[model samples]
Target chain A: MSGIFNSSIGRKFAMALSALFLMFFLLQHFAINILSVFSPDAFNEASHFMGTFWAVQYILQPILIFGVIFHFVMGFILELKNNKARQISYAKNNGSANSSWMSRNMIWSGLAILAFMVLHFIDFWIPEMNTKYVLGDMSGMHNGEFRYFHELVEKFHSPIRVGAYVIAFVFLALHLLHGFSSAFQSIGANNKYTKSLQGFAKIYAIGIPLGFIFIALYHHLTGH
Target chain B: MNLTLKIWRQKNASDKGKMVDYQISDVSPDMSFLEMLDVLNDQIITKGEEPVAFDHDCREGICGMCSLYINGEAHGPDRGVTTCQLHMRKFKDGDTIYIEPFRAKAFPVIKDLVVDRSAFDRIQHAGGFISVNTSGNTQDANAIPIAKEAADTAMDAATCIGCGACVATCKNSSAMLFVGAKVSQYALLPQGQVEATDRVLNMVKQMDEEGFGNCTNTGACEVECPKGISLENIARMNSEYLKASLKG
Candidate 1:
C-alpha cells in the first residue's frame, strides 16, 4: 500500500485524485456563489449554514484544506523531480507542437491559482471566520442568516481585486481545460466515452470559471 | 543537397559534452538519417579526426537502437519512425540540423549520440515475464482461450521497442509509458494472471529504483513512438497497480 504512492505512477495517481476532489469542491463553491446573483437572502442563508454547519466545520473543511495543500505540494515536488530527471534540456524545445499550453504549464497555472487562493482566503474566509468565531461579531443574525451578502458585494467593489479575480479565473479556466480531462486520464477511467467526456470537460472548463468571473463582474458594476 | 550538422560530442560517460558543427555537401535526399551521419563520420575520419560512434544495428525501425533527438523532436521531425528510418528528404537545401542523445539521468551518455539504455533491460528483468512450465510439454497453446479484445491489446503493448523515446520526449524524463507497456502486455493475458499482483508491484518498484521521472500524460511519447504505442497502456498500468494495492 505504501509502495503504491511511492512509485512514479503511484504518486501521479495521488495528484489526480486530489485534483478531482478539489474539482468537486469548486463545483459546490460556484453553485453557492451564483446564488447571490438571483437571490441575496438565499445566498446569505446558504453561506451562514456553510459557515456554521457542524459537519462542514469539523470534518469537510479539514479535508478541503488537506486536498488543496496536497495538490499543490505534490505538483511542486513532481515538477522538481521532472526537472532533475532531465539534467540537460534541448536548446530549442517546441513544447506547443504536441501538447496544450495548459498541460505544459501546469506548474505555472497552479502557482497562479495558489496566489489567488491566499487573496481569496483573506478577503472572505478569514474575515468571516474571525467575525463568527474569533471576534464574536455575529450580531446581525436572523432566523439563521448572518446578513453576509454584502461581504460578497463589498469585495467586488475594488476594481483591482475584481480585475485580479477575472484574470485568475482565466488562469482557472486554462487550468481546468487540462486538469478536468487529465485527472480522468490519470486514474485510467477513460473508455469509449472519453471523447464525450473530453467535450463535456471543455464546456465545464470554460463554463464554470467564466461563470465565476461573471458573478464578480456583476457585483462590481452594479455595486449590489 | 548541402546540410550543416550540429551533433553532440562526448569523449566518455562523464565527459562534458558539446555540440560540434560539420558541413557536408552532395547528400542525396533518399539517404537515411543515420546514413547522413555515416557520411559525416567518413569525412571526419579522412581529416585525422575520430569518427563519431553511434549505436545502430538494423537500418529498419524495429531494433530501436538508433536513438536521436533531432530538431527538438524524438527520431527527427517525421512521425511514426525511428532515427534509422528518418530520411534526408525531410530537410531542404542549406538546412541546419541538430542531433543529440536521449537525455535522462538514468540514460548516461556513453559516447556521441549513444546513451546506456541497459536500465531498460534491468526494469524489464524485474517483472516483465510470466511464470510457466517449459521443461515438459506445456498444455496445447490454444487450449486456453483469450478474448480477441484482450489479445489485440496485449499485442499492442508488446510492440513497444524500448527505444527510450517516451523518456526522451517526456518533460520529466518519465519512464511510465515504457514501464506501462511492459506491465500492460503481461497484465492483459491469461498467462500473466498467476502473479499479476507481484508483477506490478515489483516492476513499479524497480522502475522507481532506476531514478526515472514521473509521467504527466503529456502524450508526446505516443505521438513520437515509431510503433504508435498508445497512452492507454499507461492508464491500464495505473488500473493494474491500483487493483494490486487492494489485494493487500
Candidate 2:
C-alpha cells in the first residue's frame, strides 16, 4: 500500500478514482436539485424522503462524507508533493493566457467550492434536520412527516439566500470544468476521445450548476 | 543598431547578483547573438570596465554550454535554437533586452549567465550508462536489427542536449522532460534494457534529490525546447517509473 502511494501511477490512480466518485456525486446532487425547477412540491417531498431514508442516512451518508474529505485532502497532498519535486525555474513567462482559466485557478476554485459546501449544508441540511428532529416542528405538513421541505423553498425565496446559491453554483461549475478533464488525463486516458470528453465535461459542468442556479433564481422570481 | 542591455552579474556562487545595464551602438544585424555580446564586451574592455561574463564554447547550438535567459525567454525569442544560434536580427534598433542567469535552486549561478548544470551530469552519472564493455572487439552495429520506429524514437530522445530549457520553461521547474528523454533513449533500445529499471529509478531519484520541481504536464517545456522534445517522453517515463516501482 505504501509502495502504491509512492509510485506515480498509484498517485494518479488515487486522484482519478476520487475525482470520478465526486463526479458521480455531483450528477446525483444535480438531479435532485433540478427537481425543484419542475415542481417545488415534488422536490421538497423528495428531499424529505431522502432525509428520512434510514438506510441512506445510516450507511451511505458516512461513505459520501468520507469520499468528499478524501478527495479534498488527497488533492492538496498531491499538489504539495509535486511542488517538492521540481528543481529548475522557467526562464519565460509562466502559463499561457490561452489556457483554460479553470485549469490555472483549480486550487483557488476548489477552495471556493469547499467554503460554499460548508455554507450550503448550514443553510439547508442542518437547519432542516434541527427543525425536524430537535425542535420537533411537525406543524405544516400533509401528514406528520417532515415539513422541512417547505422550509427549504421559503429559505430560497429570499434574495440574499438565492444570491448565495448562485455564487456557490458558479464556483462548483468552475471546479468541475478543470477537475473533469484533468481526472481523465491523470488516469492515462489521453487520446482523441479525451478532447471530446473535455468538451462534454465543460458543457456538463456549466449545465448542471446552471440547473441548480435556475431553481434558486426561479423561486426568488415567482412567489410559490 | 544601438541597444541597452541589462545583464546579470555575479562573481561566484555565494555572491549576491544584480543586473548591470550597458549601452552598445552600431551592432551588425548579421552578427550572432553571442557575437553581439562579444562586441559589447570589447567596448567595456576599452573603458577598463570588467566585461559581462557568460559561458560559450563551440558557438554552435550542440554544445549546450551557452545557456541564457534573454528578455525573459529561455534561449531568446527564437524557437528550436540555442542562444548561440540566435542572431541580432531577432532584435530591432534601440531595443532594451533584459538578460539574466538561468535561475533555479538546482542550477546555481556560477557567474553572470553561466550556471553549474553539472547537476544534470550527476543525474546522468547515477544511471545513464550501459554496463557493456567496449574494447577494440565489440558486436557489429547492425547485430541487434532494431526496428526503424524504435530506432527513430531512440534518436529523437537522444537529441536532448541537456540544455536545461525544459526546466527553465516548466512552471514547477520540473526536469521531467529532460530526464524522461534520457530515460526513453535508453529504455527503447536493446542495449539499454538490461538495466532499465535501475536506470530510471536511480535517475529519477537523483533528479528529485537535486531539488527539481514535479511535472504538472503543462507542455510549456515542449513549446520552448530547443530541440522540440515532446511531452510524450515524460509520459513514457511515467509509464517506465510505474513499471519499475511495481516490479521492485
Best by lDDT: 1
lDDT of 2 by residue, A89-203 (tens): 3333535522356665666788888888888888876876676679885343646654654665688778887887788789889888777876765554555586689789989
TM-score of 2: 0.82
Ten contiguous residues minimizing lDDT sum, candidate 1 chain B: B132-141
TM, every model: 0.97, 0.82
Clashing residue pairs, candidate 2?
A: A85-B212, A85-B213, A85-B214, A86-B212, A86-B213, A86-B214, A87-B211, A87-B212, A87-B213, A90-B168
For residues A139-164, write the lDDT of model 1, one tens digit per residue: 64745555678778988999999999
lDDT of 1 at A142: 44
Worst window of 10 by summed lDDT in candidate 2 chain A = A90-99
Local distance difference test, per candidate? Answer: 0.88, 0.78
Specify the CAPRI tier of model 2. acceptable
Model 1 regions lying over 4 Å from their true place: A138-146
The lowest-lDDT stretch of 10 consecutive residues in candidate 1 chain A is A138-147
